[model samples]
Target: MNSTSFDLDPSYHILVTGGAGFIGSNLCEFLLNNGNSVTCLDNFATGKRENIAPLSSNSRFSLIEGDIRDLDTCQQACKDVDYVLHQAALGSVPRSINDPITSNDVNVSGFLNMLVAARDAKVKRFVYAASSSTYGDSKNMPKIEDIIGKPLSPYAITKYVNELYADIFNNTYGLETVGLRYFNVFGRKQDPNGAYAAVIPKFVLQLMEHTSPVINGDGSFSRDFTYIDNVIQMNIKAIVTDNKEAVNTVYNVAFGERTDLNQLVALLKEFLSEFDAKIADVNAKYGPTRQGDVPHSLASIDKAKKLLGYDPQFDIQKGLKQAVRWYWENLK
Candidate 1:
């Protein structure tokens, strides 16, 4: 059940590293709603103020405005925390291509700092956000965790390095870890105004403004468009699962289906047209494929289903409707 509530003991303290970003903010809110003590570490680099503004009033929630690149900051945030849900990172392939050094520093070195901090603190488990981009250059239909190709971008390499580092810490230091290789996760609060904005939210914003959304390649490129609630479910289960086999391993977190850019844009128009009929006329433009883009992506998610009891409740249709309504009510 993706009801935003879990029946676990709420006395534990959890830390969400990218606490003010879109996905991270959702996790923080969900964790706090379930009565866990949460410490949010964010540098406000890519994270937003409005995302976490509502959660600031909760007394049990703590905020640390610092960078993960600093070991001291990592140590400070890990203090007395029982579990660490590490989500902080520089998250765009194009941006990484432009500045790979920064990406490596934040994603690789910063990840190392978090792992060290979690290890030192002796947290029960360390759950971090991994990416499906790590499956670069692979032509697999439903990506399995064990099968991957050479990384196609600097961002992808950094994420792959995260899995490597997690494994090392687990094997070398007895640190318990779980990695959820998220597909194209989207939902409310996913910012639509950045050079590296995700396709769905960016298209929603464009259609709402009567501007054309651009497809990087042909309309055929597809993705395993996952919903935020499902992702939150995966994260929570990863944190609380009693299955020993689930620890120190990675799992695909997705809806087990794919949607092409054409279908995605059409659906956006159909839904937004309900609010403003004129949006139905707004079309999407085609452009050259992105440098590190893949033609198609769909995750098996069988491992997560078998291990964490993950049953995603939102497919693209259902999740898109909810997200469109949210944009109309809150941000439009």
Candidate 2:
């Protein structure tokens, strides 16, 4: 069945916090397209209105310009909402390390507020964006959900704390919640011009401009770069799936594949150079490793597979093709 025809009974209303960011906007679009009423709550701090501009005319989609740090805002956003997908956060390790207080306020304090609101609203299930950075300092390939090391950055600590609070809510308040530990999610609509943009979009824009992209280290660091569609699918499965074993648990949302920075540059260049051959020779500059940066990170998505029936359709290369095409047509 198509997404619209899927059996997501309308008795449930959907609330998506941060619903104007790249991932959040996509989620809102998906939910609206599937015939569900979606209420988007975003402060427009990191999120942009243009991300949801196309949906402004949709009657089923409503926007609330609000901050999650405020308990009243969170409470109001959760009202009458059946499912909550909390994606708001102050991402970027460098940003977090520089201003741990703000990161903690948004990712931790705001997260708690959302949890309280969700509990008070009695939402069916609360799902939020957990980070792969939670696997900080693990030194393990294919990081699993159960095994996490000490957080290497403030952002990691905040995300790990989200899982902790979510678990506590489930145990103490009887709230059904699921945490998705996303690993390097990237694709269309991801901001490319920010000081803290993710590597894929940043590199694509630089290459398109015939400029060299910077590799923080020797280009050996790797990540399990996942596509946005897969992340969307995971969110859908997280709420709609009836697997009791999956509830009150965390799952690694990734492609189960790792690609190094050098390989990533090569792939993006290959895909983008088609738009302008000059992009092919876009050299990469090497710099000292970034602070709070992990050497290598991968994910074991087997638990998600067995529990939520998550089957990622797009790998890194495939996702890059679509993302590159989007940037070329839209940005250029």
Candidate 3:
């Protein structure tokens, strides 16, 4: 989880929207550890309180129980903030398919609200969590920043809309922005309880509970499974960079490698079985391919490397091993 390759000023006052969630909380902790002042804004929709409970005692850490859907709350949270890591949004393609209205209200409209607030507050940079799903319907083996296809799902539509709005905000208002189109990010503090839980953590938890985890689409679908540490590194890089070319553009945050669901299941089982031998016997069940899911997703991180000096520290096997250990110690 070390990003010793880069550093930021200790006196910076940063705000992280959805700071109680998985990626956001990790960012908050990393910033706080590096002696920065941080204000966390979360509505508790998907963010868990337990994630931030440990940081409550830190003198530089402040919490604002708020939502990005509300402009005033966003404005208040943005006040005096040097940088804004905007991670507030309703995620999950299936959830968006089930309730596109709420997803739109949060991912798109809420994003607009945050942009306006950051603009008015004059935050130095607004780095937001974009999605790899924006590359939907493209047959590109390795997703590039410039080339993209039509969005396939409501969730993808919302994330693509966020990028559009961010671009407009930057061009129209002169606000600085960086959008990180995150691949399948997973790691510690990631919730494995919900119906929309990510594959890695979900499968780990199911195996720990001695239940067979189901793999969708015969376990052939692949994704660029990035670790949360790499995502944190990108966010830090996004905000701290003095390179003018890096600003107001999007970069894919990933390890630049793809892992299929079958390989993913095998890795999860292999790591989790170290704690309990019974997990080794639990076979995976095959299910239908999910809607709005692309067959394979791999990222061409060349843009990230060229612009931001983005270097990912962990690969899939290393990330999955660390994540499995965290689940066994904390949740299991």
In model 1, the runs with Cα more than 4 Å from the true position are 1-5
Per-model TM against the reference: 0.98, 0.98, 0.99
Candidate 2: give the clashing pairs.
Answer: none
**Against the unseen true structure, what C-alpha lDDT does each candidate score?**
0.93, 0.92, 0.93
Instruction: Give the local distance difference test score of model 2.
Output: 0.92
TM-score of 3: 0.99
lDDT of 3 by residue, 20-93 (tens): 99999999999998889999999999999999999999999999998888999999999999999999889999
- The parts of candidate 2 lying over 4 Å away from their true place are 1-7
Please, what are the lDDT tens digits per residue for candidate 1 over residues 38-100?
999999999998999999999999999999999999999999999999999999889999999
TM-score of 2: 0.98
Instruction: Sort every candidate by TM-score, greatest first.
Output: 3, 1, 2
Cα error, candidate 1, residue 319 (Å): 0.5
